[model samples]
Structures are given as structure tokens and as C-alpha cells.
Target chain A: MKLSDMQKDKCVRVKSLGVDAHFLNRITSIGITEGTTIRVVRNDRKMPVLVYVRQTLLALNREDCEKIEIEEVA
Target chain B: MNSIALLGQPNSGKSTVFNALTGARQHVGNWPGKTVEKKEGSFTYKGAKYTITDLPGSYGLTGNSDEEKITVDYIKAGHADLVCILVDASQLERSMYMLAEFAGMNVPSVLVLNMMDVAEDKGISVNAGELSRRLGIPVLPFTAADGKGYDRLRDLFETELSSPHLLTSAPNLAEAKSLKEQGEAKYTWITQMLEGVTTTGSLDYKMSRFDRLATAPVLGKFISIGVILLGFIVAMAICMPFMMLGSMFPVLMNEPIANALTAIHIHPWLVSIFSLLIPNTLYFSTAMAAFVLGVNLVFGYLEEKGFIARTAYQFDGVLSKVGLQGKAVAPILMGFGCTIGGTSGTRVMDNWGQKMLAMAIVWAVPCGSIWAVMPVISGMFFPWWGTLLVCVGILAYVFVLMWFVSLVFGKKLSPVETRTGMIMELPPYHKVHWGHIVKEAFYKAGDIFVRAFRTVIVISVIFWVLQYSASGSLEDSLLYKIGTFIEPVTKIFGLGWQSFMTFLSSAFAKEAVLGVLNAIFVGQSSLLDATFHAKTSGVEGMALAQIMSQTIAPAEALALIFACTFNIPCVMALSTTYRESHSLKWTARVAAFYVGSALLLACIVYHIASLFM
Candidate 1:
């Protein structure tokens, strides 16, 4: 499943990023590489995920989430 | 000797490291093609000298921005033997991405994980040895603020110098391939490495209740306006007492000094130069300088304490309702005190379009200098309501200017979403540092004093010579001829030759307008001393009043307002603009725009009021 498909407040390890090559590179460069655990901190009304990556928190739009490949760890 | 380049995003504590190594010997210069500062320093570590260049903080080495371009170019060109990538430990993921980019550069580098304390506080743990093994480089965890890991960093640098090996990694390739699929690879390769080590866990982050309410559209707007107005009220409450105190000090000092000079039987010219010119210039400049600096320091303190950012965020919510946002709020808030000061602050805004728009409309807001002068303009000629109306008129003009710029430029009016939600980390609240404030006040005052002593004093002397040489009786000199040339223009404003000369001098410095008036009437007496006595006498020591009473009707106060508002900016503002924009063309444009608009508006306002009055 894509990381965005995970339920809100659920922690899951990232399996693979299925996004377009450019964005995947960018996100990975930002330390969002696969095999890392990510927890959904909040979800907007539109279900866009806001996640904490390391020490910094980020809000990713739903459209951007369609490309993130992940597995349900919890 | 090996050279190391320290690179990281801003606020990463690089300066602390630079200070620790070089002490006070760092040389700071503006980076080529960019206004962001470049800091370079050298120090001996382990008996080998190492020179380090601290590049401006950047998120990545992509050549998208000027700062990024410089960092990338310097590294790619082999300018340094090793690059020390300083990553904030607390913000490891974000820092890691940049580190990955550096790794892709295939350059020898040592990764220094700074801010370790903050990371530890947040319950985040990084196995530095494991991370180092994975990235194939030495990883040193440091807390630059407290001077931890300096020796380790030095040792790592020395070890890297002994055997310089480039790490080969396409760690970002999979993520790159996943994201874009085409693998255009505009960015360097280390972005791949970042993908392997970073992970996030589900956590619920909620906006504070206060933040939510403050950003609520309607309430936010009301609160924003109130906050801004309150800022103005607070500034005035603080400034007025200081202004009065400043006015009193000169009066007290000048009278005694003037009397002492007279008792000594000093030559009249020497007495005039010493007692009147020097003292008045010094007092007025010092007072105004102190006033401006005091207000700025208060704002700075509030900003340092995080109150301003909180207020700005609340205001941002209000602006969002009106389709405005970002750093534009700072300039507008600054406008409440002084349009010129607001214009000077435009450089701090990161958004280019916002900077230009803010600069264009800043002058439409009346500053304290104009505010203080307005009462003098209206009381002698027009009613008090006229002064209020002038302020309102300027506000309307600014609104119209803002609208025009937005429309013409097709600039998008929307709330700016900051990459980081927090404006600035608020320093721990504490008692106001009076020592720092006083030091800053003196620093600012001294800078202005030096400028005045050098430029304004010379101008005063030259003007003095011109007026003395052109006419034996101060009536028929080149000063008068120049005033005559502008007299027809001044007549519309109820001003004669003297007022015209004063208005022209205003271009040099707004206070110089008062200075010229003093030079003409006080005739070598200290201008501040004259102003003090004039205020006591209720004439306010403004020479324009005497000229107004002699030559024109009271209705021409509108003309004087126009002249005052629209005249060229002071020398400090012009120099500031040049420094901020780093373009002579823009500076000239700003000056020309103010001068032209002032002339045109003054003409229209005078003509319209002339018919009715």
C-alpha cells in the first residue's frame, strides 16, 4: 500500500516510494528513503497526510501521497 | 594544509563554530551576485593550518537560487580540499537530504551532526558509527553552541586530508527513479543516500487553539488592525516622552553653553559656529537618532522575544482574509512609524515580488518625522482636522498605489505558506536588556552623528558661505536667487524664498530642512537652541512659518504637506536602498519616483485648495 493509505495516527514503515522519479528523488534526498518508519501525525479533511520526518514535521498533499509505496507495520 | 568548506541551511550554528575556531578574525563579505554574506576564517588545528569558508545556509546545492549556485560552484570547482557538512541533529531528516547531495558531489567530506542537545531532548537517537559506516564517511556529533566536538571535527578533517577518497553512491537513484521515472537527474546523486537512512512515524500534530482562533478570518482581521493600531499607539507613547525629554536636554545645555561662550568674549563667528551650529546639529541629530534607535530596539526586542512573530502570524491570518500575506506585513507594520524605515526593511523579505510592492507603498504611510512636522504645518495655517485629513489622504494614496502595483504586475495576492511555520524561535523571555539596548542606541546614534558631522555639517557650511557671499544682507544672495527660481512653485504653497530653500535642503536630510531654516533666521546661533526657545515662544522655531506669514495665505498648508511628503528621501534612505537592492538603477528610480510624485501631488492639491480657500 502507498504510505498515504495508512490510517491517521498510525505508524508504519515505508516499503517503497512509488511516486514519479523526480519527486521520489527529492523526497529521498530530504531523508524520506524507504525502510524508514513514518507516523501520520495529522490528516486534513481531504486526508492529506502531515508526518514528522526525523525532527522536522511536514505536510504532504494527498496528490503527492499516491506515489508513496508503504506497508502497514502496526 | 587542507581547506574545509562549512555548509548548511541557515540558523544551523555554523557561525558558532566559526567563532570558536577563528575567534574575532573572520572576514565577512557579500557573496558575488548575492546580498547574502560570505564568512571565511582560518585556524591551526593539530599543527596544520586549516582555512574554512562558511557558505551561506542553503537547503541544497541545486543552482536554483543565487546562494545555491555559489555553494555548488565553489565545491564543483575544487575550491576546497574537504567539505564539512553541518547538519542540525534535531532536524536530522531535513539536514540529511543536503548531506546526501554533498555525498553525490563525490567530494571528500565529514558530516558534523550539530545541535545534538536538541536532538537528545526530543528523544531522537542516531547511531553515528553506524550512519558513518553506511555513508562511508566519518560522522561527528557536535553541539557547536557549547563547544562540543571541535577536536573530533579537527581530527576527522586531518584524517580525511591523509587519505582523500570519494564515496560512490547512487543512493538517491531509486527514489529519483520512483518519483520522476525518467531520471533527468537535474540534482546531484547524494539525494539517493538520504532516502536510505530517513524514516517517519505516525504522530498527531495539532495547531494550538490560540493559533486556530487567531487565524480565523473575520476575527483575525479585526485583531490585526487593532494590533497594528496598538503598535502605533505604543510607539507614540514611548517616543513622545523621549522626544520631549530630548527637546528639553538641548535647551538646558545650550543656554548655559551659549552664555559661557558670550562671557568668554569669543569672536561672534567662532561663538556662532561652536555654540549654535555645532551644538544644534549634534543635539538634533543625537535626539532623532536616539528616538529612531529606541523605537527600533523595542521592536527588535519584541521580535527577539517572539512576540512580533506571534503577532505577525495573527496578522497574517487577517491579511489572508484580504488576500495578502508573507513578509509584506513587516514593512507595513514598520510603516506605522516611518515609511522610509519601512522601505529600508524591504530587503529582509525573501519574496521578490512582495519586496517591490511593499517598497512602492511604504511611503504612503506617514512616519513620525512627518507626523511631528504635520502639526506645525496645520496649526500655523490649517485646522487640526486638516492634519488628520492629510494622514487619511496619504493612506488613501498608499491603498491606491498598492492596488495599482498589484494589478500592473499581475502579482498573486494570497497567504504565504512558510516552509517553517514558526517565524523565529523566541528567545527565552527575560528582563529587557538595558545594556544591549543602550549599546545599540549609541551605535546607531554614532553612525548617524558621523554621517551628519561629515555630510550635513559640510553642506551647512557651504550653504552658509553661499548665502553670505551672494548677498551682503542675507536678502540678495545666490540662496535668494535659487529660492526665486523655485518661488513661483512655492507661491502655490504659500511659501517664499526662505521656505523654498529649506524645502530643497530637505532632500539631503529631513532634519536639514529645519537646519536650513535655522541657518537663515538664527544666523549662526545653534539650531537646536533656537528651536528650543522657539518652542517655548510657541512659534516652534520653524522658519517656514515666518515665510508663510510674510508671503502667502494659510490655505497653502496643503502645498507644504505635499512638499514634505513627496520630497526626495534622506541620504540614509538612499544609501539603504542602494545597499538593499544592490542596484543603482533601482535607487535612482525610487528617488525619482518620490520627487516626481511629490511635485505633481503638491501642484494638484495646491491648485484645488487655492480655488476654494
Candidate 2:
């Protein structure tokens, strides 16, 4: 599922970031990578969904969030 | 004296530590490549002086931007003897990446585990000695805010230590040509080095009730609105004492200067040149400048505490819907405090189109100076209801203007650059230190005062001169002729000759409008006599607003208020918009847009109000 589709407070593993190279690199530089664990801390509609990645909160607009694919962990 | 280059990721409490170290000795300027600030300072320690240079914060050394280039270049250039690296102790996993990259570069460094109090509160115990031993560096755990463990950190600064390479156990880098490979190497090394040396426990981030509301999507919108309203209301409240100052303003600034000038027995014309007019205009501008400065200090304090980031977060969706990014909110919020600040504030956005569009839209917001004078003018014209009407009208128009201009400019200035989404590490709320507020207020106010003083001094004098022609009556003045020339055009917007003249003269500085009026409109040629004449005359009130209302119709008065508020910002904002955008084309386009729109808006308001009349 796209990261934007995930419910708030759910932990997921980042699979791949289908974004522009420059943008993908920026998020990656901040310790987010494929296979890193992240939780959707805020997923309210009409607001940028905030995700908790490695003890930091990042706010991603829906346009950016839709490009990142994620999977639920057992 | 030893030189230390302070380096860290953004918001690793580097600034707090820098402030604690240097106090007020910092010199701030922009870096060569980007508009990002370069701050350096010096302080005395035990009879020796140490200079500190704060390098731009970057996530790692291998990014593509100028920030990455600048940081790497600074480190490799060996400008400082030792690099003082700061990292948040609680989030060692993420913050350690910088240290790993620095070690990879083979730079001499000492690590500081800052915010030890926060880590201790979270129950994350850092074995500083063991970690320091493994890293082959002195790691001093510290909290820069209240100077916890700072003495030990300062002592370590005094002692010479072996240059530490914390990635001692990492394997040699593979001969990978990919940029990704170099970044991954540093990332992997950080994890490997910290494996046994650091342990973590699960601790939830403490979110306040206000934070929960502010972060919630629906509630967040309300919270943001609440914040904006609270900001406005507080500014209004703070303006109360200053408004009292405004009442006594003519008495203090105008009366004395006018009185001393009257005592001079020089020729009348020469006395007019050297009269209280020039000095009184300067004084009036100083008061207006102070009002803007005070409002911005409140803005700066909130921005320091992270309210602006929350504003960006809360408005991200709405801004995106309008073809802008969430980061656009900061500049817009700053537009309330001051438009020039708003225009200059857009430098942080990476996209040129976004910056231009943001600046163009920010012109719609009525700035602090407008707030200062509009209240006074509106209260004068319509009494209590007039101020309310103009304020409510401006607010409604700002929204309409932003939407309208976006449609006109948004397509061409749409976001073409894919920018990094902001990571909202909301700063922990702290009690505001009044000391810091006052210092910043003066620094900011002093800067603006100097600029306005320059502009207003020249313009107000020209305006003062224009109050007289060779014929010397108020009607024969160059101001009257030019005001007559524009009166017809401005009359379409319900503005008369005096209002038109004030608008033209005020383009140099808003406060100069009242200054010019004091010299010209009452035909008394002096502020004190003008007040005295209006009071003794059948006019019920002695205030300038009362005299102004007797001459201008109600419909015209409302239009004048709207026109002045919505017009192009003062000369200061014009030059600032140019400097910040660094494009004469965009700056000219923005100024032309505001001038055209403000006039058109007033025309519309005038026609509609005329129908009601």
C-alpha cells in the first residue's frame, strides 16, 4: 500500500520511494531508507501526514506520500 | 586563542550552545553560495580568547545542494583547529551520521552529546566514558540551556586531546563509484560503531494537549487560526500603551520642535525650511517604526519557539491545494508582522517559482505599519465602527487578493522544483526569556529605523517643501498641482487631492503621510497651530482624524482607508523584495501588481459604498 493509505499509529516498513531522484535523496539523507521502520503518527485528511522515522517526525504532503510504498509488519 | 568550528545537523541545539558560549559577540552574514546565514563569534575563557565559527547544518557531507558543498568545503579547508560536533544524546542513531561522515573525512573533532537532560528524562543513559573510549574522543554530555555539564565541556575544550576517529571498527569502503554508495558507507559505519557502545529504551514523545490539537488535521486548522488571532490580539493589546504614547506624540515630539523653531527669528521662508516640520516628521516615523519592530519581536519570539513550523504543518494541505508548498506559510505569517520581512523570508524555499509566487501573494497582507495607522485613521473617521470596518474589510480582501493573484500568477510561477518535505521536529516549548526578546527587538528595530530614517528624511522634506509654491498659499503648492493632476484618477476610488497626495508621499514611508498632512492640509503650516485651530474652531474634536473627516465624505473615507492599507508596501519593502528575490523582473512585476490591485480594490469598494449612500 502507499504510505498515504496507512492508518495513523501503524508501523510499516518502507519498501521503495517512487519519487524524483533529488527529493528521494533528501529524505534518504535524513536516515530514511528502504526497509527502515516508520510509523504514521498523523494521517488526517486535508493535512500533511506526519510519519515517525527513527525518532524524528517528518511531515509529507499527500503528493509526496503517495509515491512511497510501504507494507504492514506482523 | 583557539578557533573551533561548531558543526551539527540543523536543530541539534547548536544555536543554543553557540549563544551560551559567545553571548552577544556573534557576527551573522549570508554564506557565499546560498542565502543561509553564517554566524561566528568569540568569547573569553580563563584569560584566553577562543573564536567559534558556526558552519551551515547539513544532514551529511554527500548531498547535492550548496549547503552540502559548503559544509564539506569548510571541513576540508581546515579553517578551524578542531571541529566541535554536537548531537542530541537521546537520538544517537540518527544524529551520529554526521559524526561518522566527519570521521570518514579524517577531520580532527571532539563530540558533544547535547541535551543530556532530555536524554536523562527519557531514561536513556549514555555511558559517556565507554563511548568516548571506543570513539577515541572526549564526549562531554551536556545541556546547553541551563549550563548543565557545560563546565566539564568547557574544561575539555581547554585540554588538548588526540584527534578522534569514532568509526574505528568500520571496514574499508568498497570501491563504489555511486554517490549512494558513499552515503550508505557512512550510514552503515554509524550503526556498526554504536552497536555495543549505545543502548536505547522505548520512550514515547511527550505531546502537550495544545500540541495534540495543533497537530490534529481538523483541530490543527482551528489551532492555527487561534494562534493567528492570538498574535493579532496580543499585538493590539501591546499597542495600547504605545497608542497612549500616540496621543501625547504631538505634544512631546511635535510641540517642542515647533516651539524651538518658533523662537528662531529667521526669515519666514528659511524658518519654514528649518521648522519643526522636518524634525516632527522624523519623530512620527520613529514611533511608527517602533510599532512595527515591537510586533516583529513577538513574531521572532514565536518563530524561535517553533510556532511557525506548526503553521507550516497545519497549512500544508491548504497551501498544496493552491499550488504552493507548506513551507510557504512562514513567509505569509511574517507578512503580518512586516511585508519586507515576509518578502525576505521566502529565501528558504528552494524553488524560484514558489518564492516569487509566495512574495507576490504576501503583498496582500496588511502589514504592521498599516495596522498602526489604519486603526488611528479608521477610529477617527467612523469612530469605533470605522476601525472595525477597515480591519474586517482588509482581512476579507487579503483572502480574496491571495486567491485572485494565485490564479493570475500561479500558472506561470507554479512549483517546478521538487523540494524536500519538511521534517517537523517541533521545538519544545520554553518560557520566553524577556532578555532575549529585548535584545532581538532592538537589533531588528535599529536596522529598520536606520533605513526608514534615510528614506523618510529625504521624502518628508520634499513633501514639506511641496506644501508651498511660488505663490506660497496651500493651493498654489507643487503638491496641490500634482495632487490636482491625480485627484481625478484617484476620485474614481473615492479619494480626494489630500488623500491622493498622502498616498503618493507615503510610498516613501507610510508615517510620512501624516507628516505631510500636518504640514500641508490644515493650511496652518505647523502641527501645534493646526491642532489649536481645529479645537477652537466649531470642529468638535481637535484630532487630525476629525479635521480629515470634515473634508472627506464617508464613502471616500472608507475607500482611502482601503487604498492605503492594500497599496504597495513602503520603499523599504520594495528594495527588500528586490534583494531577496534577486530579480528585478519579479520585483517590478510584484510592485506593479500591488499598485494596480490596491487602486482597483479601492475603486470597487468606493462604487459599492456609493450605491449604499
For each candidate, the DockQ is 0.21, 0.48
Candidate 2 docks at the CAPRI level of acceptable
Per-residue error (Å), model 1, residue B235: 8.8
**For candidate 2, the TM-score of chain A alone relative to the native chain A:** 0.90
Candidate 2 lDDT over B172-238, as tens digits, reads: 4676455555556766666666666666322244467877788887777777766765765565566
CA lDDT scores, all candidates in order: 0.57, 0.67
Instruction: Fill in the DockQ of model 2.
Output: 0.48
Regions of model 1 farther than 4 Å from truth: A1-74, B1-4, B10-57, B138-170, B174-199, B206-325, B338-348, B351-364, B402-478, B488-499, B505-550, B553-555, B568-589, B608-613
Chain B alone, candidate 1, TM-score of: 0.71
State the fnat of model 2.
0.36
Top candidate on DockQ is 2
